[model samples]
Target: MAPKTTHPVLGARALNRATLDRQLLLRPASLGIPEAVEHLLGLQAQNTKPPYYALAARLEGFRPERLSALMESRAVARIVTMRSTVHTHTARDAVALRGLAQPGAIDRELALFVSRGGLDGVDLDRLAELARALVEERPRTPKELREELLPHWPAADPQSLSVAARCLLPLVQVTPRGLWERGGQVALTTTDRWFADSDGPAAGGPADLDETVLRYLGAFGPASVKDMQAWCGLTRLGPAFERLRPRLLAFQDERGTELFDLPDAPRPDEDTPAPPRLLPEFDNLLLSHADRTRVVPADLRGRTWSGNQAHRVFLLDGLLAGIWHLDEGKERTTLTLEPFARVTRADRAALTTEAERTLRLMTPAGVPHDIVFATR
Candidate 1:
């Protein structure tokens, strides 16, 4: 066997700065929404508001209407892609990345359905074709799609049928559901129909996976293969990285796990001052890494999750500091900052200022908003 490659060692703080800089979290980026979305690979958007909040926090002049227009114009879309969850991705990535992730997502969905006897005699290929036809005709809510598919697979569970299609196909969540300040049911369309005007077809096979690995490294790297797997729910990506090894930079974290990143990516000094900022629920920063200690303190990791949902968290000095929630009233909105540990006076003041700026980005101009720190 070839001798083990020695890489630079990066402590947790150094890794934290590198990741934050790449994530556009250490400082807001100057890029437009679409460019930023592509760079980040996509934002966790199980809920409509998180994408807007995420971009607002990361972009220099992000506006809710900007993202809304992207959705309205088919420049970006909400789709079930990474980690088998809804993400708001640029239209290009919505197509390219979904195809890369579909195989595993579909297998998991089918396994669950089969174990429950919900997919008992249904032919998945036929189901996919039929589901594709239905969604292609027009974007339909999961309920509406389920109802239509039920007639064909009458014995299969309605929910399972809809989910199988979601897993198997590249379905894009149509506008209004993901539109800023607009509430609507989750609706689905095929990527092909949704981005018909785009250059090439949705990417597939190993080549796209290679692209995905590079993009992940660019956005969240100095990460291990396990971290990439955790982020995208795709396994066996080691070979993909191996192929690009010469083009990549390698590092070892404090724990000795080898990390891979783009050769030219930023790795800032460990002492870099990370600003106080609030992250949206299920922010990728918390979810993207298998070893998340770079951003989340080991002692506080267990606290970030409340059942299945991860709460919106705040960061100070590039580490998880607290959780926050918004209380929107008709006339005024209150942002409550709840810290996990004792905060110094200086940190608290900075936290308050960041919270106020976040409120301005999140709420309408005329709407009043206030920031309150929850007393321990």
Candidate 2:
């Protein structure tokens, strides 16, 4: 057996600290915005706008337009990653993730739509070939892609076509829909055309979940295989860890749940001071865990969920301390903090200061509203 740490590797705080180190939230990050974006599997851009704001908080100097440019140039693409939701990831990741995620997404759609008789005996390979030819000339909206393919697969429900094509071809919704500050509608193209302008995905193939797993633990380490699965939405990560056994350092939590970490990964003392930070709504840290009690207090988790149920949030000492809203249409921003319990005057001041600065940055030319506090 490999020798374990003398102290038996303390509990979840140790794990949480390891996660903090990899994430750079324990301290300010030194990596470039693009690199940080890549490591986090493209910053979870479902709402389309918060990834920009999220990066600005974590990265030292981030600009929304740079991500926009990367999207336009196809260096990083917008595609589905974990949980089968849209993410803005690099070209390399987009391909691999699609390969792995497509099968699961297909199984889901087939159950949901197949009983409706949309794909009885339909040859998907033939459909993919035809769909590729149909869209190669230009990027088409989802509706357009459906119409073009409908004549051949008349039995296929037009509304279900987008989900079917998503599983068949590694498709990406092209910009200016994904561009920062752009209101452009979603336009469709295969990930190849969206990234490399070819109709085919690169031959190298599916993203190795083992390699992807190591990178995940590298960025969010001292984490369990369960946490690994939560972050990547892949089942059977045990094999990935098995392949990685030689390279990893292992421990057991208080519950004796086995956990893994990178050998040289950072593990700061629990007392190590953490700064106040505002996280974007749906930021992966909050999403990428099964037992959020390690980070969010159970009493407050419901409040955090309800507060950020819409748009954005603020973090004080790594917990979701409050929620912030940006009312762009009215050119005003308001921050509502629902403290689980009473907060110190000093911490409240700190949150206010951070909230004010972020609001100003997000709504630079707009009128400002006084920050609001509501306790539940």
Candidate 3:
């Protein structure tokens, strides 16, 4: 049987279904840890520990321990890889994809610290030594490390050289620390101490490049080459796309922009019923695309994507419903929704009721928390 094909113009529904489907949020979370990680090309790990909940919400059968176990055993590693941020990903991916995104990582790190004193009078070799000595054996917080390094880099600012040197070199923050519901604190260690072999950089096609593009398309495609470039931070998807052109399925959007995807991947009916769902800060669905209109509402985009400050969000008939902030205190855990637009009283009430239920679930047994809707 021929594979099903979709026309290029994927509106909010198509985009939402694709996003949810890829995120595994549409279906109840059922996949194993490693499988889930492989599917999303890794969760947006910049926040370190939060992806576990992001995964748990999507993968019904998630075990927080599996990821920590992967991190400890080195089957997966915490590498300063994609988007030039810290993420815990399968070791195989860290080895392969980091090479592609390293330049961005390096640039971001350098820009962060160089101005304060990263490349100043001090010797870099010694700086690396100092950083290693500070964090070795045990993971250290950026704050704690900064305090210790103050004597060495008293003149340097935290942003410029401190974060940059780590970017240029390979390092991994140890975990057990990042597992779900666990008290996750940041700590650094050399990637070699854990994963040992670093994936060296290699130029396009015939190598991991094609496989990388295919994996990306399978997990995040039906997207343009530009989207692939944005997610991977790689400029050479042209050649990778060219290499896979024959095997890929293509369609032109309303603008005639070509989009590609794995021929065998799922593209559910546009009529698929999408439920209201909550997403973590830095969720990949929002960050993966160059044009996010399909999943994120323009009005709510600026606020909800602002990390924990934006809190959680809701998918109202597949469009964003602005930002949500959850406050958990001794007596109760409260959830507040900050909508970007005027929701009908009925929808507002319904959302409030659901938020209350969510609060109850988040804090079982004791006093059920209050869920409130607030105007932005």
Candidate 4:
């Protein structure tokens, strides 16, 4: 019998550097907005601005308007793909990933609603067909959708009816809803209708889950099967990893967790310099892994969240160092940084510099900005 291949080991710092390189945070990459959006799989877009700020931190020459234009042009869209949460994805990924995730994450989410008795009497197939026609005819807000869907299932819970619509269909939050500086109320439409006029890939097809695994590794690799499963909110992915093993490089993390990454993917030196970054709330880098210790220090694990909400975070030396928020004013925008611990003058200066870059890229020109370190 052939001897089993022994995997090499990777320490935490080594893993952090490798993951950061793939994340495009080792340095700003010169990539266009649509390409970057597709490369990263998608940006965690629980809020309107996270995707733009996410691109600004990872890509060179990124402007919020660039992403906004993609939204307007239907080259990218906000949809529920991974983790049963909304993400801003490229037009192709928006279609493929959603279809791939539907069998697992999306179905499970709808089951949760059904289990709660909210969809007890509703025929799901009928609901999906009606909701698809309703939204595809013209986009509708959650309220409008729920109200329209409720009468058909008068016995069903109103909130659950709309949530069911979302879970049942590959709904896209239409333009103006996610546009920069031109935000509007959440509106819903079928991905088919939303991408109907675009030259990009059309909606509804079986996405190759194996191909998705490779893309997942390119963007979030040096990751374990569980990591990708956690990132995408799917399970039973071990077969995919096994199938790709011959083409992958395997290494064990300190905990003996086997990590599989693309053979040519960058694994930067452990001590490679990782500059500070200011990330928006719910950024994927912080959420897309089972072992976040690669980026989140152990002691500060739960500090980035309150109740169920995530705070915008800043990284010092490529680890979660602080939480930050902005106070926009007519004359000035104040960026308040709250570090978990005291920092050296050098670290503080570096954080300030990154904060300035973010403000310049995200805020309107000619708006004076202030960076304040709150007393921890």
RMSD of 4: 1.5
Tell me each candidate's TM-score. Answer: 0.95, 0.88, 0.79, 0.97
lDDT per residue as tens, model 2, 178-223 = 7877748777787666666532234468877677777887776677
Q: What is the lDDT of residue 89 in candidate 1?
A: 85
lDDT of 3: 0.67
List of clashing residue pairs for candidate 1: none
Quantify all predictions' global Cα lDDT against the true fold.
0.86, 0.71, 0.67, 0.91
For model 1, residues 1-376, the per-residue Cα lDDT tens digits are 9997777899999999999999998898999888899999999998789998898889997788888887888888888887789999877788777777776654676688878999898998998999899999998888988899899889889999888888878888887788877868888888888888643244433227777788899999889999999998888888988998888988898878999999888999999899997999888989999999999888986887778877888999989999998999998898999999889999999999888888777788889888888953
What are the runs in model 3 whose C-alpha is more than 4 Å off? 1-8, 61-77, 111-118, 121-159, 195-207, 305-308, 342-367
The 10 consecutive residues of candidate 3 with the worst lDDT sum are 198-207
lDDT of 4 by residue, 123-165 (tens): 9999999999999889999899889988888988999999999
- Kindly state the number of residue pairs that clash in model 1: 0
Ranking by TM-score: 4, 1, 2, 3
Best by TM-score: 4
Taking the tens digit of each residue's C-alpha lDDT, what string does model 3 give over 1-376? 9965556576556756766676676666667777778777777777654576566567654556666666666666666777776666776666556665776545555655666454566566777787777666556667766677668766766544457446655666666556545646666676545565433222221226787788887777678888877786656568788888899988655565778888788777767876556666777777777877768766655866444453566766667776777777878777878777888887776677655544443454677577777887
- Local error of candidate 1 at residue 176 (angstroms): 1.0
Candidate 2, backbone clash total:
1
